[model samples]
Target chain A: MQESVDLGPEQCTLLLGAGITGRVALSSPDGPHIVPVNYSVVGEAVIMRTSPYSVLGTYGRGSMLAFEVDWFDHERWRGWSVVVRGRANVVTDPLELDRIRTTWDPQPWAAGARNLYLRLHWSEISGRQIGVGWDPVETLPVRRAV
Target chain B: MQESVDLGPEQCTLLLGAGITGRVALSSPDGPHIVPVNYSVVGEAVIMRTSPYSVLGTYGRGSMLAFEVDWFDHERWRGWSVVVRGRANVVTDPLELDRIRTTWDPQPWAAGARNLYLRLHWSEISGRQIGVGWDPVETLPVRRAV
Candidate 1:
């Protein structure tokens, strides 16, 4: 079995910056809720836009949430995953919203009035990579026999 | 802006069967956590394997969790996402484990002693799709200009 490696803070941050889409997990009154989101990282915070009535928008403010991104190369049987635990806050300041709009505008693919922008201030960031010695680009022919 | 459509239970099940990888959300004492996982659906339950001491393995049993899967077509600015809310349970029956192992062998890429298998019994299933009239395969030339 190939070994898995933990990624450092700097490497996790780099991976977060390179990602465009991720899943955000939040606790709701009913249960744990998660959804796919388009996001942008700004100054150690993850920013996303959603409808005010959406699950994320409703329970996001001052709530503890987790965001994750991952890449998997199926043929090579290797992948990397990053998780960010944070407190989410609504971006209400006009100047800050405008600055974020100008710097990194997030366009949510789901068509709706997604005007509310939430910023998650990360308290913990962790990452892991599987199949340490495998080449991501190379396809393994041995798997074909299975 | 394109219209968004809600998918019915049958369509949601179809989408779930088509996906192999998804993110699972669980609430921990610290906060809500989300991670990517490889899973398979069998008899209305989603099954995945993980290390016994892992966060998911430790906290998943009898806990309310959310599972999500999505497919995005960036070129056409369209996608579909499905979310399943369920309670997780550990598969302890040797006969059932053997059945699952024979039917849908979950080969987790992350190398470890992942002998524990968790099954999620879904209570709610919902799905949504963006860009109702747009073709998923058609490339939009307007995106190139930006």
Candidate 2:
């Protein structure tokens, strides 16, 4: 079977920049929640706009969260996944908000007043890629009926 | 701007069945992490296979986690997102394992002995769709120069 490869920090960052949409995972009072978000990599943080009343915007600030992006091919059974873990904080500074608006101008695809921008200060970034070639199932030993 | 529509439980489950790939979010000692996994809907739970030593395999069992799947169109700026929250459990019963194997064999694209089957017993399923029509930005009031 083809082996998986570990991606370095540089490679992970590069992949993060290339993707515009990803899933954000956050721990909330209700439990862990995962939601798709449109984000932009600005400086060292991932920034996205959300409504203050939304689940993410309400519980995300000051919480540990994870952001992930991946590309997979089901036919070929090949893919790459990147995960970033960090603390999420609201962009409250007016100047910083303006800078982000001018630089990235993150537009929320869902029509709403998603005026609040949140930045995840990523502390760890890691990724892996499932290279193409052999299939895992094809290499597995035959099983006897129970 | 076009108003977003809330998807019912039945609609959410329908989308889940149609999609084979989704992201699983779990909180670990380091922090929360999100990773993509190919899954199958069996009965009322989402099941997938992973390595016993993998982060999801180790910390996912009996832990509260989130699973998300989405389809987005960049040109149209429209999409639908579904989130499932539940506790993940490893399928240990031999009979159940045999049943899952027969019904839907989850083939891991990544190479390894990913024999451990993990199921997320979802307690809440919710989804939302961004309907096509007007754009929120176009309806926003003109910004005054700072």
Candidate 3:
């Protein structure tokens, strides 16, 4: 039987930054809800855009949330996941907004006006891999673009 | 930009059941968390197992949670996600447990004594797709097991 390995902080950060999409969980009126968002990692924070009325925009700001990205190999039955625990906030700084656009704007695939720049700053980052010694993210089946 | 399509409940259930793994979100003491779990669909419930001390086992029972399964086609930049909102509970009934074991048993890859059988009964389900007519679940990049 294979054992799970704890990933280092640097590997966690690298894999988290390379993914264009991940799921973000937040508390909603009905219950706890999670949804995928296109995100760009800037420094110690993740930036994504959504409409002002979306579930994320409505309840995400000023709330502590979790963001996760994972990849699994079906043939080998191996997988790894990076989870980020942080507090979410709306991006309101003019300079930061300009820098976000200049650095790399997160372009959400949904067809709507994704005008709200939501940022989730990392307070804790951790990861684990079931298949040790294998570079899972770099060798993804589809090689998702960074 | 292509318009997003709203999928019916039946299509949502089919896609949700076809994926062997998904992210389950539960509210924890620190904040809301999301984690990947190997799951199987039975009747109106999603069944999986976890260690009794894990975040899911500790906080998931009797709590309202969200389970999501999705597949994205990077080449076309299109994707769809099915989200199910429900209350989770520990499976303690003998007949139901026997049925779960008889019917396809969910095998968690993680190495541990996963004694707690967690069942998330779906109270609501909804889905949306970016590419209107294409079957995203059937054409998954890696084709995750059902």
Give one digit per residue, the lDDT tens place, for model 1 in B36-101: 888888778889888889889888888999999876665566787889999999999999998888
Backbone clash count, each prediction separately: 0, 0, 0
Candidate 3, residue A138: lDDT: 68
1 or 2, which is superior by lDDT?
1
Best by DockQ: 3
Question: Residue B127 of model 1: what lDDT?
Answer: 86
lDDT of 1 at A87: 98
Q: Report chain A TM-scores, every model.
A: 0.89, 0.87, 0.92
After TM-score superposition, the amount by which residue B12's alpha carbon in candidate 2 deviates from its true location, in angstroms, is 1.5
True-vs-predicted CA distance for residue B27, candidate 2, Å: 1.6
Ranking by lDDT: 3, 1, 2
Residue by residue across A94-125, what tens digits does model 2's lDDT show? 99888887767667776779888899989999
Task: Give the alpha carbon lDDT tens digit for every residue of A1-146 in model 3.
Answer: 35788888998998887787899999876779998888888889999899889899999999998999888766677899999989999999999999888878988887899899999999999998986777856655443343
**C-alpha lDDT of residue B119 in model 2:** 88
Model 1 misplacement above 4 A: A133-146, B133-146
For model 2, the superposed segments whose C-alpha errors exceed 4 Å read: A132-146, B133-146
